[model samples]
Target: MRNYQPATLKKNVRLASKFAYWLDCELSEMTSANVEDYLIHLHQQGRSAKTIKNHRSAIKVFCDFLGTRGILQDNPVLRVPSMELPEEIPIFLTDEEVDKLMVIARLDDMFCEVTLALNTGLRMEEMRRLEWRDIDLKFKQLTVRKSKSKRPRTVPLNQRTCKALETQRERYGHLVYVFPGGKGGFYNRGIWTEPKMRSENWWQKLSIRHIQEVIPSLKNLPAGRTGRGWHDLRHTF
Candidate 1:
């Protein structure tokens, strides 16, 4: 729990529960072979390497807990081999794709968010938490205080990003969040009534789906290319 986020903790708990349910015998009878077999089962189910790794981690933690309480003489999960993930190439949008995306974004009233994402390479959560107070337009810089690393950093603004911010300011500068949610709050995960509503998760998925429809290459990406989120915009930057 020291380093785990709330979401991660919940996921680990869920995975551990599933692993326990899969074992026919008592918890004390569980072994490394069982853990390995479960991993193989996950692989057979077409779960991605990253997902299997997470499952393995949760099982390890569960086994460690059992060992600490003398439920097991040894931690069986320790004997399980670590999962090896295949190399993944980062995918970014082509210049042409960006051009088309920008045109569509402008029409959809997402120009500011798209512009900031491409230019600053900020994560969706970081952008969602952005507020007017964190930006210094006079100095052309903004502070990301709630970054994934939990460390604040300053990001410089280019002319394009500055212009986009100026436009956003003129429109919704009085709001607390730079990109307020549908109800004028921080962006949250959910469907919205209007496409212009800014929900980072939904927006990324919607945009990617639209782009894939327009860009044949994206729809025909080779195996192992798996980017369907706003992080792709960061990579594009």
Candidate 2:
């Protein structure tokens, strides 16, 4: 935990915690079967391939580290079958699709968020929590303080990103969060959930409806229960 970045440490810690609960036994009692079962459990939960891969990596790293310290007889992860993942290639929108997406994003009042994702390749979670201070428009850069790798990174902003961010500053810079929902509150991460999708006035629903209308194939894109909206924008970048 001390060696890992914040996000990586959190993921590893969560993996340990969940594995402990699932095994209901000491570290020495863990076995390859237990690891396999945990992977199956994650699959059953509708976790994406990337998410399950992360979990597997966390568990493998944890077990290997402990095993070297004489805390266990074997690394169970090594004995478990490797996860069969689909192709690593991500779906991306072409220039025409992007132009259409941007038009719809504007109509749906999500232009800033959509544009930021396309320019920065930020994850949905990262974008949801971004603040005004994170962007340094003068330098044409934005800092991702809380990244999946635990290490912070500053992404360079292009002319399009800078322009969009400048516009966003005029609209939302006074607030603490760039995308506030309630009084001085950040947007809920579950805004794209099935329940929220049913809302007649939710911004996500409006944006999604328009985007799918423009790119009908997106409606059939395979995503888990959480669905993939702006994530494809990141890929498009």
Candidate 3:
């Protein structure tokens, strides 16, 4: 109900619902102690601090809403201290690393997609939904739709990006998607497949293979927990 992006709203509602289900008590019965106990429960379940923090925030907001409706005297979240989060520095790929990736990517089907990410700083999801119609090679501009910000923005393309796309278009221009999956449809499996976007995981898998092929040590690099991924390409650019 709050002004949240669709994905953020969904996460908030899901966490709030989980808390309500766990408590199995009326709003009036909820208290600061109950909220603290819920946090303990989450910690017992092995949820990470960041994840627990999100749950805490959702419950806190719900408690505030209840207060606004004259249902409580104080916000329970205020009684509890915020979770201590481990600092994480974002890692960006080096130019040599990016160049190495580019060399291998040029031989793969995702070369165009890879080039766009390196050039435009578009997210994986944004790259997935990108279509041939959204690109103007002559003008070196790309239109991103349904972005995470819930707004469309145009990304100006570099010469390398345009050239890569031009080559991709020459080969796979018949398909609606700029980066079509193997089956001539969207890359991911979902309810809506219109001009379906490729899976970020799929690209990551290929990228990892290529990276390891060049430098074996990179293969062992932690990927999910503060490791290199597609986002690093955006950071690199």
Candidate 4:
């Protein structure tokens, strides 16, 4: 934890913590059968096969790291059977629902973030790491240095994003994060969850969580639960 970067370490440890829980044993006790059961638990929990695959990848990397340190006999993940996932087309939201969200937009800061995600397709981590200097106001562009693939991409801002940004200037500032925390500025890393298709802090954080509660019209939309994770809003675009 002390050696690795914070976010990377957090992800590694989170996987380890779950592995411990699933196997009812610590990292030292992890074995081939235990790893297999973990995958089984994921299936029982209704996690998509793709999600299971990603979780396995994370667990495998951590297990391999443990092997190098002489903690495990070998990476048990390598012993687990390869999982087969279904081939499903991507699901996206209609433009009408997107417009409905805007009509009900109350949090100016969230509006900017949602607007940017809709127009530019920036992921949560990318948007969180974004500093004021990264936004190129003159060029009407937002640049993310490293996204999911660890590749930097630049996205052009449409008239809508500009208007959303402009509307946010008073609520935030040139240096303040476009998405500020309750008191002000970037969220303290303590208890923040990724904004799923639902909304930021939808599952926690009472104040911001209520944004969805207040906007009842959106609850009736089909994309509401199917792709409730906030990234679907980006996926929809």
Candidate 5:
């Protein structure tokens, strides 16, 4: 069966498979022209350049996977034209902005999110995948099961990270997850019910509100889009 089932691939794999399906070309037909056409198709679909590049990469991986299975003699992704991404200036919080956020933290969820993002370089996916069993207070470390690569990595829990986890432990016991589970268990409906290991959403949402609240002109402005808002603190270290 020459079946290309997009659903069976893992989440990331599903993305790549969809690209192959949309292109309507066999893995054997992959070439520079084919890749250019696929990228054009994605661009026409209102995908940003970055998104188009990502889809191409995903398809590249799919081609490689098929090549390994002897479905194709060569992987065409090896020769596809690469996208030249525009350079972006780095964004980091100044001492004043950091202090301002801390001053406004109070007992809000955003406060903890700010502290943790500053302390650890955990991605949104890693935070969402956090499990109670992965943390070892005795070892003073947090274990991260790599969602993308399926590898496990550990980072020493800083004082703030430890305190945050401890507080969450006391507040939401028996949930078996670092953050909280929903009424349906792991189906994150929203803030009141989002599956998370260490969610900064409350912090993110609150921070956005606080920004709009403080700046009159920004009240009606769109939210920040260039860099990850919480990521500034992550790069602070």
Candidate 6:
């Protein structure tokens, strides 16, 4: 569907599979009570409310598809309540931290990624989907076509960002993606696959693990916190 990205579609498929594995009866026999029970099971297993909510959403979509196909007369997940997440303050890098990070990134050959993220505030997914054709160096702007909000937006590039991008272009300009994967494909090839089964090229994405390794201070922070990942660069911007 136009509303679902490839990665998102794969995730939903995986979640649906997991749900089917957990259920005792056939999927056609599933009911709203079974869906509620599964949610309770997730909660009992110490799954976060957000995680359970995602499970619910995925299962809901699957049930809807089955309904459309006449495989089921009713959708099970419709009766489930939406998960309410607690509000938390976002954390960002300090000026001193940013300077240090940039210095290290330059040394690590990630200067372009770090600079572009900080300056343009693009999400990791947006950056991963970025193409050379999306940028206009002469105009000092880039367009985000695959944003989470599903709306294209133009981001103005600063001098630092432009310089970093120029360096990247010189090295990988002929490639389709600005930050191509190891085989000159999109970054994080097979990213939707199970981690243990993924190819070596899976490491090509500018992931949070890479960021944490570069900035050791981030590694010590609590998991699931805002400042621990690459998004902090966007926040810093």
What stretches of model 2 exceed 4 Å from their correct place?
A: 1-30, 34-75, 84-86, 183-206, 222-227
Evaluation by TM-score, superior candidate among 5 and 6: 6
What tens digits encode model 6's per-residue C-alpha lDDT throughout 63-103?
A: 98989889889886877787898886667888777887777
Q: Which 10 consecutive residues of model 3 have the lowest summed lDDT?
A: 184-193
- Clashing pairs for predicted structure model 4, backbone only: 196-229, 196-230, 197-228, 197-229, 197-230
lDDT string, candidate 2, 108-225, tens digits? 5667778888888997667756777888988999888877776789999999989988887786666666665532112333222221112212334345655677796587654332
10 residues in a row with least lDDT, candidate 2: 192-201
Cα deviation at 216, candidate 3, in Å, is 8.2
TM-score of every prediction relative to native: 0.78, 0.63, 0.68, 0.70, 0.63, 0.81
> What is the per-residue lDDT of model 3 for residues 1-237, given as tens digits with 9 covering 90 to 100?
556654467667889989989995788878888999999999999998988999999998788888899987788889888998989766567767777877766555456777888888887767777888998888989898778777899889899889888987887677788876553212322212235555545555555655667754366555542225666778777
CA-lDDT, candidates in order: 0.76, 0.71, 0.73, 0.62, 0.62, 0.74
lDDT of 5 by residue, 89-126 (tens): 54556666666666655434445445666678675556
Ranking by lDDT: 1, 6, 3, 2, 4, 5
Candidate 4: stretches off by over 4 Å: 1-12, 21-30, 41-51, 107-109, 183-228
lDDT winner between candidates 1 and 5? 1
Worst 10-residue stretch by lDDT in candidate 5? 183-192
| TM-score: the better of candidates 1 and 6 | 6
Stretches > 4 Å off in candidate 6: 183-210, 213-217, 220-228
Candidate 5 residue spans exceeding 4 A from truth = 1-30, 40-49, 66-71, 84-89, 100-108, 136-140, 145-151, 183-227
TM-score of 4: 0.70
Candidate 1: misplaced stretches above 4 Å? 6-14, 25-29, 61-75, 183-200, 220-227
lDDT of 1 by residue, 1-237 (tens): 556644467778999999999888899998889999999999999998998999999998888888888999898888988888899887788999889878767655677888999999997667767888898999999999867687899999999899999988876776777776664212322212232424545464445566666666466543232334466689899
Best by lDDT: 1
- Please count the clashing residue pairs in each candidate, in the order shown: 0, 0, 0, 5, 1, 0
- CA lDDT, candidate 2, residue 163: 94
Clashing residue pairs in candidate 5 are 110-203
| Residue 220 lDDT (model 2) | 64
